[model samples]
Target: MSTPVRSSPLALTVLALLHYRPLHPYGVQRLIKEWGKEQVVNVGQRASLYRTIDRLSAAGLIAVRQTERGSQYPERTVYELTAAGRDTARAWVREMLAVPKREFPEFPAALSNLLLLPREEMVEVLGERAEALDRELAGLDASLRAEGERGLPRVTMLEAEYLRAVTAAEAAWVRSVVDDLRTGRLTWTEEALRAFGDAGT
Candidate 1:
């Protein structure tokens, strides 16, 4: 059979967890939440988690390691990754880290239509966004500090580090743009504005 697509966040997460040890679905759920992997992996619903498990099993990426029965609860099937699954997970993680996908986030969408607003209004809105980003960066800083104090390695929290850096960069760029708008450094001339309006019509 052709290679199965191993692109789902949930699927990759399951593979990574199983690489440590075989786990039942409930165990997987708990571990993901406990490790904060749920922030990056979408394991919101139990049904969806089960479905992902089923798909991986069907694709020969994972297999049933055992079934557990408890007097207080129903039987749960535990799963472990096949050799192919382990290799796929490593490849998937490598590609994801190396490749930047074109993500259509709302900020860029609004930025593209910024000319619809007056320059002053755009400056005001972008100023607000910069303030929000500042708050977010502060929170991230606090979280990183706490994690570091708790002995979490810098490598383990790299995603948070990347986010903090990206937010700082964006906030700096927005501040520069706002400054340009306020100082007439990036103002539009009447003739050019009229030409643009005419072109729109």
Candidate 2:
């Protein structure tokens, strides 16, 4: 039986890249960056990428195509997707696109604990976040325009476009919430908070 590969964003990314052609770990990492996939997948740790590759190979999702050696470095193993891997890649793409899974990202988790911080400090920090989001939107806008000018297919930049849309929406919400907080429209007293907690009980 084929060993079951653990599903993760990185694993899916590796499988998708391998679907194209055989690639060594270094080649995979390089292509991820060159193709701007780092926006969706985190490949900051080379060790993590290597570990994922080992697991994929162990699971028979990918197989060793060949090993190439360069004079400057150690032997590099090229890997290609297996039949199961190709099918898994296709399934992963379909599921990820179709289903909106409940992912616990840091921002929402932090937001849940927002009341722990001082109200004024919350406003200040959130204001900073709004500014950062604005800057991000501007940069993404430029990238989108540049890609469009270069006649890059929209399919290729869908993630970037999604990111820009999300950033814009978040910025607007942050600004509105900050204004509410500053204007005393969304205020709470210690008594009110304690009562709210007691009500939850």
Candidate 3:
């Protein structure tokens, strides 16, 4: 028996692209950027993309259709989705849509440790974060507006829309926290922290 192929964002994307047509690794990377999937999928490193492709091939989800050679470029192997791959892709989409997995992101982790910093430093840092998030939210709005103006279907850009919503929410939340911190509504002193920890004992 073969080990199950782990489903990662990149692996799932590889399967989905192969479902449309056979493509080489370079083609996959090109389409990802052109289609604006890079925001949600982490394929900034070519090596990681190649690794995911190799794993999918090994798992029997995808098969090589042919290899092409050109004078100016290195030989490229084109891959197509197998029957198993098509089924797996659909299953993954359903699972992803139906379930929300617990994920640990850096921002939350940092928020957990914010007490380690002095109040003034925390205010300064969080204020900076609010500014940065505002910038990010602006970029997402611009992208969404540009694509909408181009007459792209909303369905095709659902991920971007979701990201924009999430960014806007986080920006608003961060700004609120900064305001509270500045107003001394949300803050902790070292003695208070020590006493709180002792109370837990």
Q: What is the C-alpha RMSD of each candidate to the true structure, in Å?
A: 3.0, 1.4, 1.3
Off by over 4 Å in 2: none
Which residue runs does candidate 1 get wrong by more than 4 Å? 1-3, 44-48, 71-74, 189-201
**Model 3 C-alpha lDDT versus the unseen true structure:** 0.91
Q: How does model 2 fare in lDDT?
A: 0.92
For model 3, give the 10-residue run with minimal summed lDDT.
1-10
Residue-level lDDT of model 2, residues 58-163, one tens digit each, is 8899999999988999999999999989988889889888998998889999999999899999999999999999999998999889888889899999999999
Extract clashing residue pairs from model 1: none
As a TM-score, model 2 comes out at 0.94
Among these predictions, the greatest TM-score belongs to: 3
TM-score of each candidate structure, all chains considered together: 0.80, 0.94, 0.95
Best by lDDT: 2
**lDDT ranking of the models:** 2, 3, 1
Q: What is the lDDT of residue 180 in candidate 3?
A: 93
Q: After superposition, how far is residue 49 of candidate 2 from its true place, in Å?
A: 0.5
In order, what lDDT does every prediction score? 0.87, 0.92, 0.91
Q: How many steric overlaps does candidate 1 have?
A: 0
